[model samples]
Target: MEEKRQTALVTGASSGIGRETAIKLAGKGFQVIAAARRMERLEELARQVQGILPRRVDLSDIEDREKFCQYLSDLPEPVSVLVNNAGYSIRGAIEDVSLNDAKRLFEVNLFGLIRVTQACLPGMRALRFGTIVNISSMAGKFAFPMSGVYAASKYAVEAVSDALRIEVRPFGIRVVAIRPGFIATEFNDVGNEMTGDLLARTDPDYKPVYQASGAGVGKMFVNATVPGPELIADIILEAVMSDAPKTAYSAGFMSKVFLEQRATLDDDAFDRFLTETTGLTDLKV
Candidate 1:
């Protein structure tokens, strides 16, 4: 007997985890609606995968998101999976980063995700079975010095997902948060680019600590055998297909390690560990 093909909507599908997840889902017999701000890249992805239907969607734009949702609601088949994966990081000390940048990060990472999920929920509710995979980072669990705003946004995601998971469970909807560690993606490069100006303007007293933390993070990403985004995609696939999926799945080796350490370490110990690891200390400039 041929299995029914489910429709999946993947945001941020132009690159990294979203792109990989869309391809993986399509390969697993899903009709994937790959949505991203980059139409050209989505077009290229469509050509690369048989089941992909490339659609341009900028989640940051309210009108664009509304139109995209309307299109999905009117689809012949209801979307069975929604991957909320569009987000970026702004790496800088909290004091150094502009409030505008922080707000922009939340707009895309938190509010945009909420809006898209809200649009999709009606369809998922009507269908009575769906999975929402939210891409959260290990940073969501622990705040790092240069990435506080990014971590704060992800922490918001975690809280939202937790509440949404409980609220939607009765309707046969499943919510899974995939927390990935240092995956080899363009995220670091983008973060560096976004924070360049802010870092340059940082207070001289805090500059060394910020620079040291950034260097440590850079080395962690470079030297650590961080799995690629495809691993996260695979985990999402598992979460989507399982009859009783876990509410959260840590997707990389380091993610698992950190999560475990978070569980075992006391607040003071963890702070000390972070300070030692990132070279952050109370030093007089």
Candidate 2:
């Protein structure tokens, strides 16, 4: 008899890393549930990839989340892999960013991720087999200016994944954190728009620091040989296929280097390093 195909659910599947991951998983013979807020885009993805179930889900909405969970519960096959890839960045100074905006970011990035994992845990535990892959960032390891809130959300993911890895191991569930650095995606565009809005209203005194940070970001993307989201998707594929996957996997250009530097440097030294490299100290805030 033919074996049952494993099902993998990938959030933020409209584009970028999530979309690539969905396609890759489907190629690997997993039934891929591709979910995002944009139904049309999901539909397009479904057309492109065989064995993909396009789902419209907005993680920030409580009602939508509940509905999605219900749908998952009713799936014919057990969800063997849960890829928490739905998240965005909000770029601004902490003081300049609105409280509501920050809260919304947390809603999607941190709380939403947790809720989805919670929904999947029962079934995973019951089956005694599963893998949870959380898409974190290099920023989670070490934060810089202009994207502190985004970093914080990823840091929360890191913390939660560490704890969850330990908690779920006994039940045969593997939790892995995939941290990607400077992937070419629409994320940068969204971040720039948020930063632009903040710059429009920010105090002139803080504008220089903000501009410097912006320039640093632009330079990183332009000069660095940033890989596309396909590389990350490949890493996720490996994690899914591995019987004993590592707790955390860092990928992309300079991701390991930066993470190593973060681990090696003291607080003061790290601060000074960031300041010098990003030119944040050239213009005092």
**Model 1 accuracy (lDDT, Cα):** 0.87
lDDT of each: 0.87, 0.89
CA displacement after TM-score superposition, residue 75 of candidate 1 (Å): 2.2
The CA root-mean-square deviation of candidate 1, after full C-alpha superposition on the true structure, stands at 1.7
Question: Tens digit of lDDT per residue, candidate 1, span 196-256?
Answer: 8764687888777877786665666664677789999999999999999998988774777
Worst 10 residues of 1 by lDDT: 276-285
lDDT over C-alpha atoms for residue 28 of model 1: 91
Give the runs in model 2 whose Cα sits over 4 Å from its true position: 194-196
Candidate 2 yields a Cα-based lDDT of 0.89
